[model samples]
Target: MASSTSLTLSQALLARATSLHQSSTDRVSLATFTGLKSSSTTTTTTPLLSSSRRAANRRCAALPGPARTRPGAVKAVSVETAVGQAADTALVEKSINTIRFLAIDAVEKANSGHPGLPMGCAPMGHVLYDEVMRYNPKNPYWFNRDRFVLSAGHGCMLQYALLHLAGYDSVQEEDLKSFRQWGSRTPGHPENFETPGVEVTTGPLGQGIANAVGLALAEKHLAARYNKPDNEIVDHYTYVILGDGCQMEGISNEACSLAGHWGLGKLIAFYDDNHISIDGDTEIAFTESVDKRFEGLGWHVIWVKNGNTGYDEIRAAIKEAKAVTDKPTLIKVTTTIGFGSPNKANSYSVHGSALGAKEVDATRKNLGWPFEPFHVPEDVKKHWSRHAPKGSALEAEWNAKFAEYEKKYKEEAAELKSIITGELPVGWEKALPTYTPESPADATRNLSQQCLNALAKVLPGFLGGSADLASSNMTLLKMFGDFQKDTPEERNVRFGVREHGMGAICNGIALHSPGGLIPYCATFFVFTDYMRAAIRISALSEAGVIYVMTHDSIGLGEDGPTHQPIEHIASFRAMPNILMLRPADGNETAGAYKVAVLNRKRPSILALSRQKLKQLPGTSIEGVEKGGYIISDNSSGNKPDVILIGTGSELEIAAQAAEELRKEGKAVRVVSFISWELFDEQSDAYKESVLPAAVSARVSIEAGSTFGWEKIIGSKGKAIGIDRFGASAPAGRIYKEYGLTAEAVIAAAKELS
Candidate 1:
């Protein structure tokens, strides 16, 4: 069979259903949930199909063309089909309510989770999981599977309920019962690491939708690079469910603008227009025309007037979204916050808090669901049971197609296989360049560009760009073109001036293939404040994104206090599972890249310099692996009288200070503390060998805040660093004025020793 994208939604559904139904020995239904149109509104429902009519339809479907339709067939078949659709609608309604009730019961059990979004968005969730998306429930990491991100992550119960129905072992019935409890797979918010089916960790509003944009970008890039006319292997859509809160966030607009500019056709977003927030109606703080704004941003916009029971309308919107192959589509689904609750529906009280016991009972009765809590009716369960086997068959069919494609296109298959399986090419690290003391001095930022270009040549997954600071950050890949709407095969991603979106989008790209896509983003070091939330998520979600931060200190000079990063380095050092590397020169810069590439489970931030620095003696890529290593030593047995430590541009100053102290016949040692986090991970023996605890005369020099230096420097030792903001002057002038110099380091060292 060909790729599913080649067929219309209805055709694909019918074909798969007929094929599966015919192959089964027992009664297996892969039937579509159809409904009758309502006279007053788009929301509608029909009764369950009668057994006889369903069997007749199945028999007719399995037969040849002439036997399937007889004389006067068009009118008769239409009438019968309409009747069957009307009957099947009841089953659809039950399935949708199953999702809503599961969410309600879970929230009521926890009494601390959000239930309104799940209750209101059940129809949307049900249609997507049961009908639209293609996936293998047993293999959540299937490369070709559609990615779904819930930007409104507080309503994660909707996803957990759907996952349970769709046969994901990660979200079983017990997991649902344990929602919001510690150690449960179902957390209060969606976390990709904790939950297998979740694509990315989402909690802060707008991040998930931005991540969806990156996911779509990855798909488009891979498809353009690997898909042949006859064999389209890399094909998938990225779907997101965002709410009013996500829209209110500026990060969402930043990412959505790029999504529209890039024309990510396979990105379809469902805007949950419930009009209710935690503080009551959205009218208090939001009243903008979201649909019109999306259209202005170049997105194809559709509005579903009623999302409560508009099952067919939701499906149709997805179909239309898939039809548009240029720009991303946004379906604004208007819904009641709590659709079935008698008193709380559409109210702020239901937005977060659980419906009390009385209200839960009232909701159950209001929806005509007479079953007990957490109960899934046999009929609804039976209808959804087909998805598991169908999903397995879909995956198996794709595997067979891939095996055939591999035979004909061996080279392309090998490359794509590495991306799919996350296997790196052998000896890829040899691509990183090494420098010697004789080499000309250059900014670590400039040196970083060399490492980036070299890595791009060897690592197929290596790709990134700057946040409109490509020149200043030195992050452009010289061999590749920009990854534009038409030129997606190129590696360089132009994220424009969107710093927060750039960081979050890279998180999505890094998390897309799990260790396969190494995405790095760049901006000025101080600008990290703009994207700190996304960066924190990167660390929390274990998205190994390389953050190329230039202008590491007061070194950028004339840009003044606002551009300088006095406390940024110290702040990131406080964050866990993040490598904060301040590479001094060429060798150290290469080493930082090595660490970033090797540590696929932890993000690495390389704080590089704007000013040129000498490629000092004894600085090596091997030494950088140790995180903190002795670059030079004139003393014996690691017992120097005065040990001076530094990182990035300040390392050069410490080395100068060590040379002067040694000339005075003082036992001096210079250490390059490139990465404090990595150094902390070292064995105590290695750390002792580098910074012996007995040496109390330790003095450190850096151009940033001295807040955390006390950990490495003894209480008696002095740290030479600027605690105040930088001034707008020449770098050398600012260095002297701020006491970030060799003289300052030497003076501090003498005072300690």
Candidate 2:
């Protein structure tokens, strides 16, 4: 068995050699240098050898490297030597090793963490941080700084190491030691809220890649909106490091396809193609040509033969990516799994587990690291500190340029500054349009259009585009210029059919821009599921993005069950810190907008109706602000025998039901519940006053599922809702078929009573 295993390994190596030879002349070659015997056959024309050589040659010709040579003649080079020694190769290598040691030590100290990635890809991280990236460490949120994302977030040690070494203010040695502990800056996974340098919270694989695309989109939007011919204020690149697991996620495919379609040239991704995953070798499941797949998505694809030490090659690939201004780029970089450990290196055993004290000591000794655990050499620390200065020079230089730009272009500079700091212009809220009962009846979508126009007039930094449903969603603000490719004057974005990308991009815009502007995106409420992941990130990041989702329910009649949202409201409300508002009338709609805009640390979704709602006589802006209000009181007494509660278009049904109940000798009260999240947030006294424990006979009516309504209406109370998906029919027919009418509400009220 041992001899057979050796023979198989030998055959594999010989095949790799032949493939490398052939790859240079004809096709792209991917060679694995894993268990090869030196005693393998030396025949030059061995099929494997010829194929490998041709493949290798083709790959070399595609990159900006030395001329192709004989397949077996390729020399193994260290990272510093690969990128160029003119930039202090020794210091760079020391910093890279420092990152590796810190990661291993921190993980070992914490007794928890995925250590394989940091150990394997330290060279890539070092190259990007010391040679390729540009940023002001003093200000991690520098407006034009390049964005870096660790898409494989379980390997957060990789990111934490870079943050600390790069001198980011939030990461420290103690933070590293406190990893995975409550209140620690270094959590098990990267969280933007917990750490200053984290671009996005990314543990659910593929999310960070989507977020990187969003960041790139934000950069493009900002550059189009704020950049002048002479001042490229918003130009910056978004870089991401991903692993095999990240590629396996479906969301990654969705995001990458959209990124490729949108032609996000500023987005560059380095795929750590380290053949190993938790399950085993990638060949066990994944075998597609990743490079070809990316090429199909319209991305510029490149490869680095030895990612573990090819720092020069990595740097050159990034530079080449930057020069291509037409599409996003992906560089496939092959690397080992656990780079330095003796027994565990290149194996899954070292993926998540910590090396024991004995093993760690041996590994450190092997690597020539003599210091104690968590101890850094003074020279190494000083070297890295010098590479990424802690001084205020970058900021000071930018301030001078800003001062000069302000002098030359005062209005533009002020607007740009306002946006960078996340401050709304004075009296911007005053421009929010108001609607009265006397106005002509129209769909809530149309009312939204007027509101958008009014807000656009006052808020110069308010930017958003819609999904393909812009016409129906009424999300367009005609007064503002359209955000088009290569157009700097336009502030309004056009996201085409990319709803998921739009949501994620809005998060990026909120993150990239300071206080001056509030980024938003619009689409049908049903489509929110497509962008739900991005919305969660917005809530998690406290990015004040507004999701204007129209076509809120079954009332979106003929579009069929697929377009109708039956359980969306309940699903959205389930998310922590997300406000879901469904307004009944124009006044309440405006109130929802007010609360949404006022919330600077939370994300809000305005679920607007496709049909017009009759203006209620008692509807007022003040009542809407309170989240829920008594639209009508019982004429018989202050205490009502039955309560009819409803939201959105269903409120009208509840109102009619209340009138009928009154005729039946019941003291009925009608309440309009617009925002459940906000209402729940109200004081208990206020809540008790609104619901009143005395009112046991309560009926809550809505066109959606009954999941969340149970909290508002107790077990004894009845809820009238469409518990299942809708069907293709006219709005009125669907309402009748689903029992969404005043009669249904009256029956439910009677049953509860």
Candidate 3:
């Protein structure tokens, strides 16, 4: 059982079949599917062997003998086995057609769905689901299951049909009929939240491929960490079927480049190279050499000329992809948009629009399918009936193997279980290094690094890296090495400088094994503009990614206006389910980390500063958790004359201004607003206590745009912020020029009073 080389889908099946051959000695002929090579010397024995002889033969095969490593290789076949395989191949074709027409019927039923992708790519889908990929349909949460992402998610009916045929209880005929309808699991795009078998929420074109890369990275890392040479407990492949649009999007390049750089051999992608797009022909916009581009990106590329009919070529290409155990592979599958349509085969009408009732009937007639809509032939069902039981049995066998694994390595097994369940260990929060007012002031970005180091020691699920900005962003884990192709067990991931790809990859990692991995990525705060789409997907799909954004404001200084973020806070604050935390000091930074870790269904943006500030006395962890808390109470313990609200670097300005106002016998309450989203979730009593309706004389100050502050500060309040862009100068000069100072805050507070 020692794994010297990475196991592909074919090899894993062979291993399973080999194990079965040992237990069922009477069924020697059944070993043909194990990809075992037969020689002239080996003879097919009869099933009438005596029990004693059979037991000895089985025991010998089960024990270590010569290596049996040729999976999907050329093997000698007898006449009987060949005939049986021919019959099975015919059944496979029928299953493929069943997938095609089911999608067609569903799209026809829902007059607002895409049918072309499923029709053209049905053969590839069938080959992947029935002939190659491994999973337990009864339990889509299998840890070692192969992941399939439909990057061309507009073609989701293609996936839905496959899931239905593969026996997943999640997708039923009624679900298909309710496609794109309210409360149906089948949405317009393949949403991971909506569909059980869907891996990542796709439809934004290239993000799915990027998510696939992250999925493959997760498998490789876990396989390297927990997998023993003898017991490869963490093992699986990540497959994606993408279209021309996915390749056209720039994010695909950013992610695929990293995939190739990491040499993710288990990551196989099928590029459905259909020439037609929504705007007629793809030739008008996208005519680059994709094969050459993939080759340059360090991927193994193969071409299938006739994806409509070349089932054997598809199978061969997969075998070839699985053979290359050092680099990822892409199989360019050439297909017509509408494969069986009489007139609209390669036309733009087939891309998104339904093929109408007449075209559907004509296409069905041309394909010689006489069944009614949503109908599966009896032979097709009989052929596919074994898949459910087979999948369940495979899972049962793996569970038995894992029980042995747990017994031998108890501690590793416990840690792996924690990762699988995504449960933080008791007292794990103690690892978050605490700070006091007496502690030396440091940049929150630097404080974030300390948190990473502390959490790296405690949180078993914690592992991520920055987008090529780890050194400056203070995101490096001290004791861990980089998660490279050679050192996958390392906690730190190097995501190059691709912000968009980094965001999607983190999402994929969070979604991997259903939130088994707690992932975080970093970059300059302003650069969020580049990856906003992926970030939105993270919020929509509920991936709890820690976005450690540094250089949060004008405090970043001479790097200039492009690096400074003025309106960025307002932008992300507008986004739902994302915590926009701007911590003023070390303690507040630790609080942000705590929220990010605990909120398992939402992402958090920890906007850290480039400059250091004094740790204020009232800035407790409890206060920071409230999102907006009273840092300094009014001197008189009654309704304050005015309230000064601020966040990040500007909070200190508000505090200084409040002290000055208090010296003048004016009772001023300074409020530290760290996260608006977290604040909005608080009880009305809590929010009212923090910002009382009676205290209408409020003044807010931050270095960002004044767009969102009106909600916090009422009509009687004065908002002091730069509504314009910043300038290239020293940090102090920029803040002074932009009116982000204690003097300016005091003036604004006086004016409001």
Candidate 4:
């Protein structure tokens, strides 16, 4: 079944086929699919469907459409078959066509979107929603159900159609009609937030696969943590359908390499080898052997010669993938882009454009689809009646299994249940470290490790690692073993040097983690550019990822300009829905971690330091939660002449500058601006209290770009920072050379005052 074929799901098929053929009062609708009909034979070679496909279609929610399909319009499998009768082949074809047409109708309605993917990949969609994956439309978050990710997310219409047909309330006909319009459930791409059954926000090429790896990782971890040998829970596969664009992206290589290295047996990716891209044929820019590449990365590769019509091959590939319980599988399925399109098949013309009304009509004729727009034939509706009920039954069975498990292992069950409900253990926050001025000065990175280790003791949901920089990044959870092939129970994950993949993988963990586990990723602050796309996805998808970025700014030293992050702080601060935190000392570091833990709807990037920092007297966890606060003010009992702001290593500089200014008989108020995004979320009155509007004399001290600081410093204030690349030297010298010092801040504050 593969270049490295190991086993097949023959036993699973026997069980699956039996359950499907069992006597049932309910029926599932079927209305669509174009078989790879051979001219040489009378027996149409219906694409081979795997065992998962029979149950797959049973779960399909049917959409009621017009009264009929075209006379002799590729006769569909009838839905009125009796029990024990091999499920109607015609019904399967009809179901496949329904999906195809639904996608076309949505794309046509939107008047925008990539129609080629939906039309071409509908068969695979049917195989997954109808046959492969298992999920209840009523409760899309069922713990043990398989997950399906559409890596080619531009064709979200396909997923939307499946959800609608599969009876998921997440996408109704009205939502489908809205298409890409504002406030629609169906956006330009599949958004997990917008749809219930949607697993992760995908579409940026290789990020989805990385996310899939994360999902599989979470499933494996949970199974190991909670599952007993007799009552197996957390058994599910993470299936991803990726296209040529996804394969071409380098992030795919990073993620897939890890997927193989980790031996994620439940990750089954379908490589949609539709050789067409936006510009033209993929051969123009992408000509590498994907199969060879995956194999080199230690993946089991399978070649499906005729994906369009070879249903048997697709089914068999999945069966074989399931049988191998050690490594991930990549099934390369070659299909024509815009399949069945008389004129545009296999061409880029069908990639992103709406097939014109004329072309649509011609195509409808070409494929024998006579139903009106958004029509789901009734026979199809009847066929899908069993999916919802079947899903409910499956969920009930799981609940019963879990009930038995809970009875035997009370503590384990309670923990698993807590995770599923997104609840932290009682008094988990008690482990956070507090600091006093007498506490020895320490690098914020070192303090960050303390917070991480402390939190690890309390929060089981908190698990993370650095991109091959766990030591330098200080992101390791002490006493926790590494998450490797053999030990999925370990909290620390070794993501190698793949920063981009690490971010994407973290997104997956956040998205699929049952109880909303907070996944964190770390690297030097300077290297964020390498993983910006994944980070952007994390923010966009609301995957509350904690990005523990150490070696912030020139303080990283000796690495020079190439490693100094001059503009990164400003760049990330400008980004929406992310906390860009640069703590001053031990207390602020704890406060930052506290805020990060509380804000589970957005991502947080802690820009920590390489140099030592003394704990400030007035810093508190409560103040950090409020976003920012005054560390020292009105010591002389008069209106402050100037307000000083600082973050990270520069906070000490600002504090020292404030001390010098206060000695000169000027009242100075020092404010710790730890998190810009969090600060912006605070009340205007709160912001004004921290930085009074009446006091125009102010200065901001930070070791990065001064771009966004103007929002706080104002026109009358000066900003002390390094706007350019730094030179090779020790941390202290680099800071001094860049003018990021107490003396420079004092001079700037004096000028402003």
User: Number of the top candidate by TM-score?
Assistant: 1
Candidate 2 regions with alpha-carbon error over 4 angstroms: 1-87, 387-391, 480-482, 488-492, 635-638, 663-666, 751-753
Q: Name the lDDT value of residue 255 in candidate 4.
A: 92
lDDT of each: 0.82, 0.73, 0.80, 0.77
lDDT of 1 at 3: 37
Q: Which candidate number would show the highest lDDT if scored against the true structure?
A: 1
Count of backbone collisions within predicted model 4: 35
Lowest-lDDT window of 10 residues in candidate 3?
49-58
User: Tens-digit lDDT track for model 2 on 687-750?
Assistant: 8777888778889999999997878888789889989889999999999999989988888787
Error of 4 at 367 (Å): 0.9
For model 1, how does the per-residue alpha-carbon lDDT over 554-638 read when each residue is reduced to its tens digit? 9899989999999999999999889999999999999999999988778999999999999989998888888999999999978
lDDT of 4 at 734: 78
Q: What is the C-alpha lDDT profile of model 4 across 614-718, one tens digit per residue? A: 887788888888777899986443358988888878878888888888889988999998987778889988887787778888888888888877788887789
Q: Order the candidates by lDDT, highest first — what do you get? A: 1, 3, 4, 2
Candidate number with the higher lDDT (1 or 4): 1
Tell me the RMSD of model 3 versus the true structure. 11.4
Number of clashes in every candidate structure?
2, 41, 0, 35
**The CA-based lDDT of model 2 is what?**
0.73
